[model samples]
Target: MKRSTSNQEVKKLNRNRVFRYVNSREETSMPEISAALSISGPTVLKIVNELKEEKLIREVGEFESTGGRKAKAIAAVRDVKYAIGLDITKNHVGIVYTDLSGKALKHERVRKPFKYTQTYLHEVAAIVRRFVEESRIPKKRILGMGISVPAIIDVQRDYITNSHALGIYDVPCEELTACMPYPCELLNDANAAAITESNRSRTCSNLVYLFLSNTVGGAIIFGNETGIVRTAQEKDRGSVYMYKGNNWRSGEFGHMVIHPEGKRCYCGKIGCLDAYCSALRLADQTDGDLERFFREMEAGNQDLKKIWNEYLKDLAIAVDNLRMCFDCEIVLGGYVGSSMEPYIQEFRNLVAEKDIFENSGDYVYVCQYQQEASALGAAIFQIEKFIDTI
Candidate 1:
C-alpha cells in the first residue's frame, strides 16, 4: 500500500511538472519538456496526451527543426480556467481577473468607501457579480475568488482576527464575503501582493515584500523548501511558501516600533513604523496625492524634500530590520513603490549605510506589478489550487 501511494504521488508530480513547464512558456516541444524535466520520453508523451485530452494544452504549430521531422509546439490553454480577486480597502474596492496563465487579464478600481456593515458586504457582492458579467467569463469557469483585506487573518478558523484599517474585529470570513456568488477565500493584503511579486519571477524563491501603501504591511516568502510545512532545506529548487506565523499574523511590519517616544500611530501605539514610514507620510503632505508628492519633490520643493528625507530615514530603519531578520531580498511594493524608480538609488544608499553584512543594497528592488497587485495576487492564489490538482 505504501509503495502504491508513493507511486501515485510520483506520477502526479511528474504530470504537474510537465503542465507547469508548458504553462510557463509561450510554446514548447515534447522533447524540450522531457529533457528539461528529466522525465522519460514515454512518460512525457503520456502526460502530454492526458493534458491534451483534458483541454489544458493544445498543439500551436510545428517548431523549425534542426533535423528530421519538426517537433510539435504545445501551448497551455490559458483560458480553460479563470479566477477573480477582490481587494477591499478603506476607501476603494479593487477587482481583477486572471486565467490559468496567472496573469491579470483585466482590472478596475472603484471608489467605494468601506463601512463595517451588512449593507457594505452586500454591495461588495453586487460589484463582483457585475464585474464577472462585464468580463464576459462564465461563472462556471472561475475556479475560486480571493478577497484581500488589510487585516490579521486566522487561517484555521477562517476569520479576520483584527483589522485596524476597517475598524473591525473578530469578523467571520463568511460574514464579509457570503454574498458573493462564487467560492470565496480571504488573504492578507500584503501577503496577496507578495504572491503577485512571487509569480513575476521563477528564480527568486525567498523575499521580504514590504508594502508601502497607506497602511504599511509585509509578507515573507521562502523558497527551496520541500513542501508547505517547514522541513530540511531542499538542495534543489522546489516549492515556495509563505510564513504566516503560528497565529497567522506574521508580516505585521507596520507595527514594529522604530522609536520609543516618537509619533503616534492609528493603532494607538507610539513610534510604530506605520506612523512614520507609510505612504501617507508623503501623500498627506500633498492632499493625499502620492504622485503629486513625488512630482513636487522632484520639481525642487524644499519642504516636501525634507519630509521625503525623513520618510526615507524611517523606511531605511524598518527595511534594515527586516533584512536582519529574514536575510533575503527586500521588495518594496504598494502605491509608493510604483513611483520609486526615480529615488530607489537614494533610498538604497540610506539602507546600505545601516547594513552590517552587505556593502551594497542590491537586494532591495521595486515590485514588478504595481497596480492592483493585492487583487491580482488574490486571483492568482485561486489559480494555484487548480494547477496543483493537475
Candidate 2:
C-alpha cells in the first residue's frame, strides 16, 4: 500500500520551498515567488505573512510596477537565527558565528593544542559563551553549535574514531558537548569545508573539494537543486583512485606512493604524497614558515624554488588523477589552497603539463575561503537542520 502525504506535510513542504526560494534571491515579490514556484498567489501571501510574523523574512522595499500596483519585495531575515561553528584542530581552535544565511558575523582563533580533557572542553565552552554574549545574540535565537575536527567521526555515537594528527583516539563526544549550553554536533573538518563551499556555489551540482591543511582531506558532492550533499564515506574522505575490490587505506591521498623509497612519511610510508605536497613540506623548506618560503622563492631563492617546483609536480599528479576519476570541478581548499590563488595560473600550467587531456585548467578552482571555512561550514550545518525541521 502506498503511504499518502498529509495536508500538513504538503503545507510544510510548500512553506520550505517558498522559504528556500526567497532565501536564494536578493528580494522577491509574492507574485514572483508564486510564479517561480508554481504556487498560488493566495498561498504565497499566507506563507509570506507567516514568515514575516515569525521574523524569518521582512519586506525590504517594493519592486517596479509592471503597470499599476508596485509589488512589495521581501527578503530572508539574514540574522533571524544564529549558529556557532568551532574548528578544533591539533594546534588551534577556530570559532565563527554565522547567521541564518550562513554568513560569518564574527570569527576568532586561539592557538591552543587540542586535548581530550574536561579542562580543555570547559575552556572551549567558556570561549563560546563569551563569544555569544559579546555578539548580543539571544540564546534562544541560536539554533545550535557544530564542531569540526580533522578526524573520522562517528556521528551516531558522537565519538572521535581516530585522529592521527592530534594523536587522539576514541574520545567521547560528551567531553565537549557536555560543556556546551546549546545543542551540538561533531563533523569532519574536510566535510565541513565542503559544505561551506557548496553553500557558496549553489549553482554547481558536482564538486570535489580537497582540503590540504596539516592533513589532506576531501569531500565529493553530487546532486542537483532539489538537494546536494556530500556522500563520501568516512574512510574515503580523501583517498584517490581506489580500484574495485581493493582494500586501500583512507587518507592515502597524503600517503599515495608518489616516490619510490624517497622521503619517509609520518605514516611510516616511503614516498608518500604528504612528504612532497603538504604545507608542512613547504614549511620544512623555509624553517616552518610557508610565507617565508614563498617570499624567498619569489626573491629568486634557487633552493626554495627547486623544492616548490618539485612539490607542484607531485601535486599535479594527484590532481590529474582526481580529475580523471571525478571529472568535475576540483576545489583546492584549506590554508595552503587559499594562499595558492596568486599562483593559480602557474599551478594550472603544471596540471596541464601532466594531464593527458587538454583544458585541465577549466576543472580546477581555488576555494573562496581560507582559514575559517571549516568553522563556517560547521555552523551552516545547524542552519541546515533548522531549515529541514521548518
User: Which candidate achieves the best lDDT against the true structure?
Assistant: 1
- Model 1, position 180: C-alpha lDDT score: 83
lDDT of 2 at 260: 72
Give each model's whole-structure lDDT. 0.89, 0.79
Best by TM-score: 1
Worst 10 residues of 2 by lDDT: 236-245
Q: Note the clash tally of each candidate.
A: 0, 0
lDDT of 1 by residue, 1-390 (tens): 353436776788888888988998999999999898888999999999999999999999999989998999999999999999999999999999999887889999999999988898898899999999998997778898999999999999988999988888998998887888889999999999999999878664689999989899999998663223443322222447789999998999999999988989998999999999888899999998988998899899999999988888898999899989988889999888777888899999999999998767788999989889999999999999889888
Q: Model 1 residue 358 lDDT?
A: 75
- Model 2, 196-247: lDDT tens digits are 8888776645777778777777777763422334332212222122121122
Worst lDDT window (10 residues) for model 1?
227-236
